[model samples]
Target: MSSFVTPKKWLTVPLEDVILRIVGGGTPSKSKPEYYQGEIPWMSVKDMNKHVLQDTVDHISQAAVDNSSTNVIPAEIPIIATRMGLGKIVIADFDSAINQDLKALFLPTEVHRDYFVYWYRSVAQKIERMGTGTTVKGIRLEVLKGLEFALPPLAEQRVIADKLDTLLAQVENTKARLEHISQILKRFRQSVLAAAVSGRLTEGWRSGDNPERNFKNLGEAGVEVKTGPFGSALHKSDYVNGGIPVINPMHISEGTIKPSESMTISHQKYTSLEAWHLRKGDVVVGRRGEMGRASVVESDEPQLCGTGSMILRVGEDALPKYLEIILRSPTAVSYFNSDSVGSTMVNLNQKIIKNFEVYFPSLSEQTEIVRRIDQLFAHADRTEQQVNNALAHVNNLTQSILAKAFRGELTEQWRKDNPALISEENSAEALLERIKAERAAAKPVKKTRKKAPS
Candidate 1:
């Protein structure tokens, strides 16, 4: 009742009562191999991810620091990623240089560093409003300082920070536990697939009454497997609005075809590339760069796969789905790896695949094997999906917690206890005005770009 509070509850304080300093940073000459290889630690927005940054892939030296616009961040200063990471913030524990894509805001004595971090993130809506542009978005320095928000007292701020830290830590621990479960699920997937191809999966399906059908070496099974249509004619511009999907290596990950992100061609183009065009159940393998990774066509979409991928339609004796399981198995991977030898880049044509000796059950038994494999895989996939879903939910919750902590709402009880020790503030008007005056009075310091090394 003394100042700024509701019966339900809220607290308010001026913002300028908090800020100590604001500084921008830049990178040293990356062209100078010398600047890049030195002992000093350097960070980029990409490297900025949750909590402590124990190590960096790149470093620069004192000499590079002296030459570059990038400043050496003192300990405990908050480094905010303005782009790339786009909202990631971390406290610098050691001296470091950041690229031009970040901002360093040093907290003042009255404001808790953790509290300021929470507040900056809490006012995300306001930050987003100030952040404008088409190519990339960010708030202007002047505009950010001028930004206003209701704040709790110093004591309340610390409480909010403490609660946030505790809750966020719990979220992180939960995610790590989920990831561990996820890894176990992945291993289960590999084990199931491996067992399927090794003949162990169909052990009971083998009828003593049924005759075993032997698989012809892959080449004899069909013809020599050939590379995909090798023409630069398929330029990016040639891609049509819709037609046949053009599958790339990225589409085939972990030996599975992902049709979601697909490029298309005209039906006319599809006819011309008929030899390379994928069919209903063709087994495709990636060669050239990736070499022997494989997948099977599951989509009804008519399309030509890329040069990085090779397509082979096995004979009628070969079951498409059955072949897909084998090709994805570790045994098939090792077989491909062995045949496509000699160069760092493993290459295999129809000749090598045709020569691969594969074991097959009779048609009736083959169908049974596939059915059993699919049933077990369905169970494994369901478990993997659960872990993935849990990870996503945890990630969203963590971010939301961070968002709330920054806003004074996170510690409403603490604010009530502290009760407007200071008052007459609804927004950060004082902070805004102070920043403007400081910028106006400050003299510009020139920093020159360093020459590249020869």
Candidate 2:
């Protein structure tokens, strides 16, 4: 196996040499509910998500520990997953019992705890790739022990760990802030929609005309609601590779129609189901499943609405874009959800769509409202895109930092500045010799059997 190439003063050693002991864990009898009721945290693969695990989802009793192969690992020790969650590592905050999938490593005093943890994290992906099993993949003990470890002097190890701690923590904080911004952008878009449909967004434009804000049912304001074809009307055999696209509920997202080519129908089928043909300026909506999913058709594309959707043809009194915004608003969604039929899957009928009340503004006012809402929404979309890009960069920055730390690039200056720490007596080779001597001294001597019959 290839070994890790370290600096001249550093040493590359087998992982087993640095570790004092490797302890495997086990699960208590799950049949006995009493075994799980105690205060000791029982760690499994699920609890290994965080870098520093404080508590677990389960707890086990002392009786369970005595009855099972599981062992308690003390706080601040490094625990890694050998199965399922292959590459993860965590330090326990309290003394915790581990299930069969985890292994707790006991290191010598000479090895920096944080340094080992960071190094393990750097090679986690490599370890994961070494895992083997038909079902739950796991790394064998031999494979783990045989793995190479790049060792620097103890002092340099500590310095590298300290630098990583500061850098990675800053990266995490920046990511958290970016995530918070993404959430804010979501709320901002929803707020814009809420204001647009409520007539509040167009209040300024309405000042000169003071036209009567008529509240009328959708049908009264001139909108014809038509449901799509039934299942019997469209068959699977009618679908063709290059045919008219079908607009399904899944295709309608964020006020736009994204037709699926695979769900398309042949020209013959489209001609037979001509009543469901989509027209430009028509607002298509999902009639089943999630409510308030809608989009306005902006093109004269030869597309047929799927069985799970409905069409809203707005008259001159209402703009199609404005109607789409109204249907997708929170107020309309709440109404549809409460009034919709079916216990397993909710559905909307033509009557429900036509009877829904809407804030009817003048045709000119509807145009202005749609324009303002679109402008605001576009701005929010751009901001969200930028935030997503930044989040991607921040995520990559973590691995980049870890790679640099392991390559000795992070402590290059410190190594040059403090040559004594990495030279002769304080070198990595000397550290390994010290570890070897300690292990030999700690070995227990076996007692010789005396001659009983003599």
Candidate 3:
């Protein structure tokens, strides 16, 4: 125990001492066609994301629960995900039935539910790490029953919970505002790209400059478009340890080239596929998944276009960077989707890519547009970084608050203000005895089910 928590008033006890019951739930039989689509909310790991669950993705009939191992838990119970999600906890807003992955906790009247929920969150990460399994790691019933935690007097617990609620609400509000700003920034970036590709971005500069405003097809501009090697020309067996990197659609993200995690081809294979070699100015576009996803090859390293991709080598008439920006624009992306082939998975061929039209300007004007876009984008990046840093600090602050809270530091002043809660009537030990007595007295009640008329 930390120096902050004086053991005289704070009693360290096993979870089972304060917990009235721990109920393990089960799933209804999936083979029973009438088992589902009922009024009872059936919760799974996915529905446990929120702090409280008002409804679930699926529901089951009461007959289903009667036929299977599943049981319905009452409202206000805190359900902890024991298996798949591992430590995800949520309180039941309404009566709910859970799958095998969840275990609901029934806390004694002595322990405050909100207080325990916040405390559990602080140790959730540690509990998750202790789990062991080959596929889905989970905590056993013994582990949960044996877990120990320090409990403050009931009044102090309520005060601590109320304080945290006020503080965390402010933090959540700020985070939501930052998230909204991020969404606006995304729309701003798309607007900039849309204007740039439509010849409207440089309308002011065009008044004094003699720029080509005509829209022309890519093939008419002397650009060479080629697809990657297919059929027997390239095989998975040809890949070796390391010779040349293959640029795939996965390797291109956010308009930049990234290192490939896939296999590299041999030097002989590289020589055989010399036509697919990528150059510094070449713009590579995904020819299959996510049509119109393109990236500018800024690296001088030797690389070849991998399968499911296309390469565009621009001549003196056009700038490769400018062409890539056009390809990434909303208009070109829509065109690519419309012209794509294949039923299950739409793909682009060399012909469709070669005939795509784009609004062109003089080389100098293109350079200016690129320069302006870079300037605005850099500012946006800086703002985004600041937002991310602030959000990280907020996350760290939550953990810090929890640590201080569990250490009894949060209510130190409150403890001094309210001294009556330290007495035997309201003390944690007295409360434990009362809970035990209540359970002991309630056990002998016999339920008499009346028989039907004979």
Instruction: Identify the leading candidate in terms of TM-score.
Output: 3
| Count of backbone collisions in candidate 2 | 0
Who is ahead in lDDT, 2 or 3?
A: 2
Q: What is candidate 3's lDDT per residue for 31-131, written digit by digit as tens? A: 98788978999988999888887799999998988887777989998899888777678997899988888888888776889999987887787778878
Whichever of 1 and 3 has more TM-score, that candidate is 3
Clashes of each: 6, 0, 0
The local lDDT score (0 to 100) that residue 132 gets in candidate 3 is 83
Show the lowest summed lDDT stretch of 10 residues, model 2. 1-10
Best of the candidates, lDDT: 2
Count of backbone collisions in candidate 1: 6
Residue ranges of candidate 1 with Cα displaced over 4 Å: 1-17, 124-129, 207-216, 220-224, 231-239, 253-262, 291-293, 298-301, 341-344, 403-454
lDDT order, best first, reads 2, 3, 1
Compared with the true structure, all predictions reach lDDT values of 0.68, 0.89, 0.82
Give stretches of model 2 more than 4 Å off: 1-5, 29-38, 61-67, 132-137, 226-251, 257-282, 287-290, 297-310, 337-352, 438-454
Per-candidate TM-score against the hidden true structure: 0.80, 0.82, 0.90
The residue pairs found clashing in candidate 1 are 16-431, 118-406, 218-354, 219-354, 224-350, 225-350
lDDT of 2 by residue, 372-447 (tens): 8878888888999999999999988988898888778999899999999998889898999999987777667889
